[model samples]
Target chain A: MSFLEVRDLSVRLKGGGPLLRNVSLTVAAGEVRGLVGESGAGKSMIGKAILGILPRSVEISSGAIVLDGTDLLTLPPAMRRQRVGATCALIPQDPLTALNPSRRIGPQITDRLVDILGWKRAEAEARARALLHEVQIADPDRVLRQYPHELSGGMRQRILIASAFAAEPRLIVADEPTTALDVTVQKQILKLIAGLQARHGTALLFVTHDLGVVSKVCQSLSVLYSGKVVEDTDVARFFAGPAHPYSAALLAATPKYTDPTAGLNPVPEAVIAAVRAEVENG
Target chain B: MTLVRTLLLRLMTTAVTLFGVAVIVFFVIRVVPGNPVAMMLPPGATAEDVARLTALYGLDKSIPQQFVIWGAGVLHGDFGTSITLRQPVLALVLGRLPATLELSVLALVMAVLMGGAAALTGTRLRETRVEGGIDVANGMALSVPDFLWGLVLILVFGVLLPVFQISGRVTPSLHLPFVTNFYLVESLVRLRFDLTRDLLAHMFLPAFALAIPLAAIIGQLLKQSLKETMHLDYVTLARTQGYSEARVIWREALPNAILPTLTLVGVQFTFLIGGTVIIERLFSYEGLGNMAIDAVINRDLPLIQGIVILFAVIFTGVNLVVDLTYAALNPRLRHG
Candidate 1:
């Protein structure tokens, strides 16, 4: 079995139509798998489902999110909570809002470490300092005492990364972790995440709309369209030549910085319609 | 040092606010068409007697001069004397001050505890029939004013059940050992649990009456703020971190949500003090509100001004505390 496998996962509003339909994907140990799609293509929903943090309105209708051969969907709630931060962590998007504004940076990072890992305060503080250093933050002590608003965006994202990795979980679901950051900070953050994953041998499910980001950090890519995974392939093949029609259209639509005069190609309505029909048929 | 600086600044602001209120109250009382001298004089008294009474009370001076004299005396903690009550205004106000303070404080405590619990429950049970029921009840409570609440309490608990005392701080015949503070505290300090019980029994109806409206206001504010805060990104982050629903609500959402409610709490407290007028009169509770009304009826200018100034001081002091609390609760506001 893979390190984390989501099989036939489906999510829908409590009394409404499906928001995610029969999506399946896997990330092997130490591998970084990217889930790339447009804004409403259910990319984040899959991540939320894995962490079991979907909004009250939405529920997983049919699915087994098996992490390390355990079906998380069937686990009791208390056990599920135990498994979430200890085995699986999420590096959320929008660092400004993701951390509690009223809390100091130190406690926000150390709370999960103490709560999930059952570490003593002294041990957690030591580990937190080390995590901050690992995330390349200088002056960890000063950063620890500061509130979220006191830090710059890059600093906040870095602190969030430290927090996500604090428990040394086996899998980290990074949902557009660098999307809100500037290009320079984005590259640094992506590199930091990759370096941390490599050092920890932690698997990652990286969700984003930016294909360039996927190319830089992801090893394999899953192309989603209208609540379905249209293509799941290695990163090299996805960039060199896509297998699915929707994937091909998505690749075509991406603006290449190397080819400045290559005008952006918007995905045609016909391609979207064809993909939707294919998804609905089976 | 910063906290101290912030406190000092707040104190300065409070001083300026009290001064402004004193000026307004002094002039406003003077402008009201009445003569304290006429009220004090007997029916058969001549013009000479009226003039002598006016000079005696310093009403013969210019308005600003009278204010300066009153203001100076106020700085020395002297509120002159009530013309009708035949006592120092300061002494009368202070005598009734503890009762008002006790009632107001108890009512405020009850409001916060009940409102906070109701809000927490409402948010947790949101979108359910229970929440809907709570919303209806809160609406009904808010619709009725505190005086009406007092009357209703008197009718139900006092007249019908007859379980609790309807009026007064304590039974007239039962005077316990009096210490400096209100009866409850004095009783507690003296280890007089019997008197404490009696005092509490007498206090229950009036305090509950004053609390219902304030509680409704606070609960509504808390519920709305908590709902909005629960939708914030940090709440989701807290959930993802495996914090339980209760923890997320109390730890993650509450600090942020409660900041807005602090201002409302302060304003509501001042409202409660103002509300004590009708509540005290209806219940025959000897509080500052009752005295202020009596002063108004008798056209007691010194007494009226003293009570207004005291209310303004309490109002300003409450606002200052609220501002400091806001700074303490929210780190963003702390430094700025």
Candidate 2:
């Protein structure tokens, strides 16, 4: 069995129709799997559902999220809560908003260690400093004492990365972690995340809209279109050539640096309609 | 350095506000169609006596002159004398200030505690039948005015139940130490638990009556803000960090949600002071509000002007404190 398995997942709005349909995917131990899609493709929703943090209005109509042989959906809420951060963690997008503005960096980073793992205050502080250093943050002591608003956006994102890794979680769900960052900072943060994930031998479910990011960081990729996975294949195979029509359209739509004069190509209307019909019929 | 600059600027603003309040109060009380001398004199008093008394209180002078004289006197802590009470207006206001302060503080505390509890409970039960009930109850509370609540409380607790005294800060017979003249504190200082209990018994109805509407307003604001704050990214991040639901709600969401509520609390504090007039009258509790009402009725110009200026100062002071609190709670404001 894979380390994390999302089998036949379906999510629906409270009063509205389905938001995510029968989506299935898997991640082997220490492997980085990417979920690539446009906005409203239910990529973030899947990440939230796996972490059991979906908004109140959204419900998993049918699905089972299995982590380490345990069905997360079947566990009691308290047990699931305890499992979060210890067994699975998340590096959220929009780092500027992800950290609590009212809180200082150190306590926020060490909260899981102190609150969930019940570590000593001094020990947690030490580990927090070490985590910050591991994320390549200089002057960890000053960073810890400062509030979220006091730090730059990249610094805040780095701190979030450190916090996500503080518990040495078995799985990390990174949902567009570098989307809000500048180009230079984005590359550094992505490299840091990839390096840390590899060093810890941790599984990662990377969700992003940028196919370029997926090509660089993800080993295997799942191309999602309109709430459905149109293609699931190795990253190398996906980059070389796509198997599914929607996947080919997505690659075609992505802007290539090699062809500077080639203005972006919009996905054809017929392709989107076909993808939507496939999801509806299925 | 920024803190000092901010403090200095606030102090200058407060000074200007007080000066403006003094001028407005002095002129507005004079504009009202009532003569302090006419009210002071008995039925047999002569016109010359009225003139002399009017001149004595500086009412005979022009409005600007009267303002200047009153302003100068106020700067020296002299608010002239009350024509009806035949005491210094400052003395009369000071004597009653403690009672009003005590009542306002107690009412404010009650409002905060009650509102905070309601917000927590309502937010927890949001999207349920119970939340609907809480909303309806809050709506009803907010709709009823403070004085009406005071009358209802008097009818129930005072008349029907007879569980508490109908009026006054303490029983006339129970004279605890007069350390601060605040019955509760005086009782405590004197170590008289009996008097303390009596004071609380008398204070309950009035404070509760003043608190109900304010609590409803605060509770509704807090509930709405908390619901929104819970959906914020940081709150979700807290949950994913393995913090329990309680921690997410209180530690993560409450801090952000409570900022707006703090401003409301400051506003409601001024309401408490204003509401105390009717509340004190209903309970026959002698506080600044009751004194102001008497000053208005008796046409005591000095007393009325003095009370109005005092209230204005209080309102401005409360707002200043609220701004300072905002700075303390928000680091962005602190640095800016």
Candidate 3:
């Protein structure tokens, strides 16, 4: 059964225009699904919708965000937050800025547990320490006392990963979590997230632009374009042959390391025009 | 270097600043085309009488020579005698210092409370009509100067309602039990509610008049900072963690947002203290600022110089405290 389902969900700029157009996707428990798209494709918006942290400039205009058995859009604000908090967490992009600079790492991680879940301080600290270890951070005890600026980018990302998993939420939204890290650190972080997702048996809504990352970690994939889901399929067959022309172009556009002599193939303007027309027409 | 070293460095800088203020104020007031001795002289007095008075006060000496003599007296804790008051400038300035401090500190506290409330309200209700109203209100407060605010406050609270003590520091007729001029603090410490109430009643209008525009300034800066902080990635991460909007704002966003606002408050405080000149005179309160206006009218060079030096000291002193506070709030500085 799907642990979280977004059905015909539409988000619009307040009294303006649609930001997300009838978008829908799902993640079953223990399944890792990559949300693939270019910039402004509403990939991260889906993750934000699930987590209910969309910017104030936009509002969820229609449809249902069903987490477990409940439709979150129908619930009151407080109840919805409580439900989301109990079941979902986000591994945000930009690790440096994702940790509060003024606060210590320990409280930033333990806060969700202690404040929201009413977990005892000691219990939350213990969980945080263990989660840090799970995320491959060393000297968890020392790290907890340190400020965000005191740590490196990789270390900060690890701390953020640890924070996201502190509550052991059923669903984790990785919103381009490795985008701001060094190239070397990116692989390690990706590996750590994939391992943690497997070990915890958590449903993962992994949002990213990199198809290579999806090839490594995701079981299923959703290809997005202009707030619409162009294609949704299992990762293996989708990689083997993307059903949509835009998806094929996106794949082709990604530089292949296997053939370094082959130059980068930019996504064709013809393909983009057709996709834009199709999405706008709908 | 250690904190001690840093503190010693700041103190040295402070001393240099005070010395600069002393030199500048003493020389500038002399060059203002007014003779202190002439101001002191009775009408129809001869040039010989004026010359005698000038020589007696050491004002007849060369300007630079007079500065050296005054600087020496300052080193020995003698700020020279006030020509107008015929008393030690140090004693007179010191006598008025606490009254100014008490008023300034009370006004500062009020501003912080009012500004904090305004900022929190605006931030909580951002992009709404209420936030827009607060911004407009803040602009209104900022556009009007403190003296205008003082007059408006007096007209509304003092004359119209007739509820508060509009002028003076306390009920002068009552036998005061205060050992210090810090009546507000001393009375509260002594559990003297009646004295405290009476003092606050007198201080309330003046302090609030000073506070309104200051509070508005702080509110606008802090609200803008808070709005920016709310958009940062950490704040978004905080929201994703399932924390309530209040917790995300108060706990996560506020700490980061308050840093810049705190610095502004610190710098604004120096200006706030300087602002007491017009405020104190308008209120008829006995403060250094009120004394400063009197000295300037009489061209009492020593008294004016003394007041200016004291103002400089307070400004630099507040800036030092702010730097230390900024360090405490920012962990990066604290650990580094």
In candidate 3 the C-alpha lDDT for residue A219 amounts to 100
Off by over 4 Å in 3: B46-51
TM-score leaderboard ranking: 3, 2, 1
Quick one: RMSD of model 2?
A: 1.9
Q: Can you write out model 2's per-residue Cα lDDT over B1-336, one digit (the tens) per residue?
A: 988888899899989988888877777878879877887679989889988887887778899888888788888999988888889988888888888888888899899999889898888888998889889989999999999999999999988999988788888986566766677777787788988888889898899999999999989999999999998888998888777777788999998899999998998899888999889998999899998999899888889988988888888889889989998998778777
Please report, as a residue range, the 10-residue window in candidate 1 chain A with the lowest summed lDDT: A109-118
Backbone Cα, N, C clashes tallied per candidate: 0, 0, 0
Candidate 1 per-residue lDDT over residues B1-336, each given as its tens digit:
888887788789888888998899889888989887887777999988988888999999999999999999999999888989889988888888899989999999999998998899999888899788879889999999998999999999998999998878887797666957488888998899988888888888899999998899889999999999998888988888888888889999998999888899998899998999889999888899999999998889999988988888888888888887888888898767
lDDT per residue for candidate 3 within B1-336, as digits (tens), equals: 668989999999888888888888888998889788877778999989988888999988899999999999999999999998999999999999999999999999999999998999999998899999998999999999888999999999988999998889998898898787788899999999999999999999889888888899899999899989999999888787677877788988899899999999998888888889999999999999999999999999999989998889889889989999999999989888
The candidate 1 chain B region of ten consecutive residues with least summed lDDT is: B174-183
TM-score of the first chain alone, every candidate: 0.98, 0.97, 0.98
What is residue A182's positional error in candidate 2, in angstroms? 1.3
Give the lowest summed-lDDT range of ten residues in model 3 chain A. Answer: A159-168
Higher-TM-score candidate of 1 and 3: 3
How many Å off is the CA of A26 in candidate 2? 1.5
What ranking of all candidate models by lDDT puts the best one first?
Answer: 3, 1, 2
DockQ of each candidate's interface versus the true one?
0.72, 0.72, 0.81
Better of 2 and 3 by DockQ: 3
State, as a TM-score between 0 and 1, how close model 3 is to the true structure. 0.96
